[model samples]
Target: WAYPMQPIQSAAMSGIGYSPIGPVEGTWVVGFFRDGENAQDPVMLGTIGGIPQNFPGSDGFNDPNQVYPLSNLNFHGLGEPDTNRLARTIGTDILGRDSKEHPVVTQKLSTTPLFDESTGTPIPYPGVPIESEGGDIRRIPKALAEGNFWVEPPTDAPFTP
Candidate 1:
């Protein structure tokens, strides 16, 4: 789920659950993963998007204010069974982030595997290089493996256009 990290554009946009930290819009953000002492490899979950919803206003506006979904939301990651190391890592990485900044949500499955299609298993971990269609290729990190991550939206999440 390697998403493009972008820079915040304004003072009004400089808080938790805000937009990303770069110039690209809605780039794929990645959540790293590991197995025991070894970094298992990261997974390509999905892109982050904004969602809009209504909220009650305290200033006596009478009508609820239109707010982004992630503005007041908090997300918790679910750990898979039978793995103590996995549980610990999940707790530290996913739960450790500020809910206002990094909201948690379910990770979506990718249609394409990060490894070579001819081989069902992953390509070489940590150092194997991958070539893409647009002449862009590089060695992927070991933190990106199958089945080890999730994503969540913000409370005041905006509508991604």
Candidate 2:
């Protein structure tokens, strides 16, 4: 059986710079997973990884000539936006290979993923807050790490070690 499914949205960011500190190039990865108990697991839904974009003020990298990829994990604002603010992006880029075997880019912007400041609950599937002591939040990661949520030998390599 087959049916179209809405992409499950997830994002990870790095190399963020703001204010007196100039901007650095940033990258993000979005993953789509099937719905179910194994939603955290892969259900044939693939992941888009290593997408690149620049910080607010930089064309590419703050140090474009640097020999290695720079990381800016300094954004301290996740829940405290008033205390610390950061820049972000949201959209979709469909990647594929054409007849000539070249990459194709198709970008679409639908709804934006907004954080619910109204709720204090940390997302419960990935892991515990590390501040709390127990619950599915604590058990889920250990289970996933041991291959319980999804089938063994995930279709795609596990992103975490």
Candidate 3:
């Protein structure tokens, strides 16, 4: 049996509160065996992440139920990492995004925002922080522009709210 490690954030109590999930299929983990020479009891330390270039195989060590790296023509965020780009500290500033990265973050926020055809929600845009001084997002931004930025249906979409 494989023994998995948990982060300090996990309470590790009676199977409740903040537990690190065990690695799923296709996840690359690094670890060692507790039994040393026995090499039977593997201890999974952590998972390795990267841009998944290839799809999972049919046999082993891969996702069995679904195909991965879905066709770019069929899906968005194909080459993106597990964590959203806007959530990563790539450039200096708010929402982990800066004006410096071309075509990645803020640049696309204004110039060309991709919207959801069904919901009209801008898919490419990140949920901007609402606070004035530092953009804290805890409270909603009361005084901001509001309108249908996407398309024009015959009447308002069913999701108008």
Candidate 4:
């Protein structure tokens, strides 16, 4: 889903001058995958736009016309697994596009095949284990207390959140 940022303000010194603010106009792709999921490796789950090329008032502030790669911005403040929630919530910032608010305009992208299509068999990635179910993988809290199961967080950075 692409978040398109609009120019909100213009330079104070010159009314016609550029705003020199907000995210650039372009496309960005965000992906999520199971540690070893095959068939659909590196799933194309979503896209976002209006990502800031640079923070306001920072170095390179004068060059509003220059476009930078979206990957350079701070994805670190995203916090944790719940970062997804934040990204969805903050649909349009002073800079980036938020996914939660603009479902239609954001444009959801996916790599999964259509169910009715008759194509080649799904191939699993080498050495990747497939989970039997396709749903929330969290263990039931009650089940754990009853000694029916145990749950632990994956040490892997990507899976932890």
Off by over 4 Å in 4: 1-27, 36-40, 51-161
User: What C-alpha lDDT do the candidate models reach, one value each?
Assistant: 0.29, 0.28, 0.38, 0.28
Per-residue alpha-carbon lDDT of candidate 4 for residues 25-66, written as tens digits (9 for 90 to 100)? 222345566556564666544433332334334243233543
**C-alpha positional error of residue 48 in candidate 1 after TM-score superposition, expressed in Å:** 36
| Best by the lDDT measure | 3
Ranking by TM-score: 3, 2, 4, 1
Quote the positional error of residue 17 for candidate 2 in Å.
Answer: 15
Worst 10 residues of 2 by lDDT: 130-139
Per-model TM-score, in order, reads 0.15, 0.18, 0.36, 0.16
The model with the greatest TM-score is: 3
Off by over 4 Å in 2: 1-67, 70-87, 99-101, 106-109, 112-161
Q: Which residue pairs clash in candidate 2?
A: 15-72
| Overall local distance difference test of candidate 2 | 0.28
lDDT for 135 (candidate 1):
13
Model 1 Cα lDDT, one tens digit per residue, 23-130: 122222444565645777755343332221233345542223332111222221122211121112222222223444553433322224357788767653342232
State residue 36's C-alpha deviation in candidate 2, in Å.
46
lDDT of 2 at 79: 30
lDDT tens per residue, model 2, 23-59: 2223222344666666786443322223234323446
